[model samples]
Target: MQVTHAELVTSAVSPNQYPQDEIIEIALAGRSNVGKSSFINKMINRKGLARTSGQPGKTQTLNFYNINHQFRFVDVPGYGYARVAKTQRASWGKMIEKYLSQRENLQLVFLLMDFRHPPTELDIAMKEFVEELDIPYGIILTKSDKIKKSQWTRHLSLFKKDLDLPSVDALFPFSAESGEGSDLIWEIISDMIEA
Candidate 1:
C-alpha cells in the first residue's frame, strides 16, 4: 500500500450522498473510540488524514476516502457511545444498516474492537448484524500495543472464542500507533480488491 494520494472524497449520510463509482469499497466499522481514524492514517501513511479525536462519537457520518484511486475506504459512524442522543443513535443505526445491507460496491468490512477488553453487548450485536447480512468481514483487534506481545495469541484466542469466529485467519491484532498489523491488513484488503 504505497499511498501517494489519499484524500477524503465525501462525508455522506445516505446512499444518495455516497460516491457514485463502481470502485470496490472496504468499510471500517467499530465502537465510538476504537481508533478507526488512526488506523486509516497509518494505512495511508499520513498524519491526521482521518481526524482523530479524544472525544468519543465524533464521527457522525460515513466518510469516504479514495486511496490512490484504487479503492474507497468507507468509514461509517462509530457505535456504542453512551452520551449520544437516542434519536441520533437510531438515525446512525439506520444509516449504517442501509449502507451495509444495500451498498453494491461494498466488498468487505473490517470490524475494529478494542483489545483491552472483551466485546461489549453492542459489539456482539454489530457482529451478529453483519453476520446476518451475510457480508464478508474481518476482525481487527485495536490497541494491541497496550498488551504484552507474549499475550497476544491468548488474547486473540479469547476473542475468537467470544466471537465464535469462523476462522482465525479472519482476525488479527492491530496497533495504529506503532503501525502493527498494517501490512497484514493491507494484504487482506489488497486480496479483496484484486478478487
Candidate 2:
C-alpha cells in the first residue's frame, strides 16, 4: 500500500467516542515500548505521525488512524509496565478488552513482540485472550534490527515454542530502522482490507 495520505482521525477511550463509520480496522497490541508506534510509522512511511516515545505506556487511548481513508489502524495502550498504577492498568486492560472483544468493525490484530525476547507472561495472556475471543491475529517480531541476524532464528524459535505456535507462517519480522517486512506487512493488510 503506497500511503499518500494518513491522518489521526481520533483518540478515543470508549465505544461512543469511536468514529461512527463502517470502515474496517486493524489493531496493534503489544507490551509497553514494544515498537507499536514505530511499526505504524514504518507501515505508512511516516516518521513521527504515531509519536514514538522512549517511555512505556505513553499511549493511553485508542488511537484511530485513517489510512488513506480505507481502514483505521487502532493503537491500543501498551500493557505490563510496572510503573503504572494498578488502578490505571486495570482501567486500561478493561478498555483494551472492550475494544478487542466488542468492536464489530475490527478485522485483524497484529500482536507485536520484541524480537530479542520470547513472549512474556502478559503477551501469552494476550495471545490466549484473543484466541479465546476468536479474533484473527498475526504475530510481529519487532525490533529485528536490534539483534544479530544469526540470532533471528533462535529468537523466533523461542517465541514459537513459548507461544506454542506450530509453525512460523503467522509471524512477521519487522524492523522500523531498516524498513524490513514493511512491504509484506502492508501486502497482508491490503489483502485483508480488500477481502
Best by lDDT: 2
- The Cα error of candidate 2 at residue 139, in Å, is 0.7
Q: What's the CA RMSD for each of the models?
A: 0.9, 0.8
Summed backbone clashes in each candidate are: 0, 0
Q: After superposition, how far is residue 161 of candidate 2 from its true place, in Å?
A: 0.6
Instruction: Write down the lDDT of every candidate, Cα atoms only.
Output: 0.91, 0.93
lDDT of 2: 0.93
lDDT of 2 by residue, 70-187 (tens): 9999999999999999999999999999999999999999999998887899999999999999989999999999999998888888888999898887889999999998888888
Span of 10 residues, lowest total lDDT, candidate 1: 164-173
RMSD of 1: 0.9
Off by over 4 Å in 1: none
lDDT of 1 by residue, 89-149 (tens): 9999999999999999998889999998988888888889999988888889999999999
Best by TM-score: 2
lDDT of candidate 1 at residue 86, scale 0 to 100: 97
lDDT score of residue 168 within candidate 1: 76
The residue-level lDDT of candidate 2 at 163 comes to 94
Candidate no. 2 TM-score? 0.98
Candidate 2 weakest lDDT stretch, 10 residues: 151-160
